[model samples]
Each structure stands twice: as structure tokens, then as C-alpha cells.
Target: MSDKDSESISDAELDRQAEVWEKIAHRPEFEKLLTAKARFIVPACVFFLVYYFALVVLVGWFPELSKKRIGPANLAYWFAFSQFFMAWIVAWIYVRAAGRFDRLSDELLGEHAQPSETPEK
Candidate 1:
């Protein structure tokens, strides 16, 4: 449908459409996907935050520990650099997890996903 056709849809029709979608959203398959996503995301975020702040707290509290040498660069410098690697590792892990999430989502929406003659962009 064109943008104008969509815009012309009345409030009552929109409300009815939303209600239908809301019912679908509450189905068991959708809930399972949501739970799976949350199970990975919540703990992963918490781990990242805690590790980041722990490094900050350690650096602030014990300057001597941070200043200790590891070859040329100090311990703190190594630790600081590792934070970037940590973020990248977490992102990589999430990317891997997203494959599972996408599969679950596809399974949940498979019945509702309308078949098209042409491939979607």
C-alpha cells in the first residue's frame, strides 16, 4: 500500500489492528523468544558493567598496584588496554548469541510471516 493509503486508515481500524498484534505478541512462542533474549542480555550487560567498574575502583584505590611494571608498560596500562579487548570480546559473544536469537524469532514468526512472490529487501 502507498503512504497515503496507510495515512487514510481510520483510528478504529488502527486500534483493531493493534489489538490483533497485541494478542499475537502475548502468545507462548513470542514469550519464549523474549525470555531467551533477556536471559542472555541481562547477565551479559551486568557482567560488562561490573568488570568495567571493578577496574575503575581498583585503579582508584590502589595506585601502587596499577603502577607496577610489566616489561615496558605498567600494569595499569595493560589493564587499561585490556578493557577495549574485553568490550570487543563481549560484542563478539553477543553476535554469536544473536544467531540463536534470530533462529528463535524466525521460528516464532514463521506462521505469521506472509509469503511474497518477490524477495524482500
Candidate 2:
């Protein structure tokens, strides 16, 4: 095939892909997937921010309380350190949630995927 033929083929493929994506975007399943991701992400973000800021606020506003030693380190230090673990825990939760998201995406694509004509060797 010539370069022009190849270019036209690629352009046609892109156009078809766009059309398919447009259809998928309008699908209820796609909306549900978006909603589910938002539902988890929005609250997770809120919780993380609140927890992170609460530590800062406590340290700033109530230095005496924050200075109270737990083991060798103070409450502020412990809280700051715990943010790392909190981040890891949130990431773990998101990974678990993302499995469901992947499943939903797979199901959506499975429905939408065009059957290839003559399997490539």
C-alpha cells in the first residue's frame, strides 16, 4: 500500500475510534463508572485533606497538646509520620477500588470493541 493509503486508513481508524468513544461516553455504564470513581475519589480526597490539615491545625493552635510526648516523639511528630501510612492505606484502598473500575471498563469495552476482520498473523 502507498503512504496516502496508509494515512487515509489511519485517519479512518481514528474517526471510527472517536465515534465509538462518543457512543461509549453516552452509555449508562460509562456514567456509572464515572460516578463510582468520583464517589470514592471525592470522599477519599476530602478525608485525606481533613486528616492532614487537622494535624497542622492542632500543632499550630494547640502546641502544648501537640508537644505532649508519646514514646520519644511528640503528638505532632507522630501525626506527621502517620500521614505516610495514611497515604499508603489510601493508595491500597484505591488499588482495590480500581480493580472494580478496571472490570467496569473492560465490560464497557467488551461491549463496544469492534470485531477485527481477519486476525493479524
User: Stretches of candidate 2 above 4 Å error?
Assistant: 1-22, 115-121
Report lDDT per candidate: 0.82, 0.85
What tens digits encode model 1's per-residue C-alpha lDDT throughout 7-113? 67788876776777687688788888899899999999999999898789879999999999999999888888889999999999999999999988888768664
TM-score of 1: 0.74
How far in Å is the alpha carbon of 87 misplaced in model 2? 0.5
Please identify model 1 stretches exceeding 4 Å from their true place.
Answer: 1-14, 114-121
lDDT tens per residue, model 2, 67-87: 999999999999999999999
Model 1 clash pairs are none
TM-score of each prediction: 0.74, 0.73
Task: Work out how many backbone clashes candidate 1 has.
Answer: 0
- Tell me the deviation in Å of residue 80 in model 2: 0.9
Q: What's the true lDDT of residue 22 in model 2?
A: 80
Worst 10 residues of 2 by lDDT: 112-121
Error of 2 at 70 (Å): 2.0
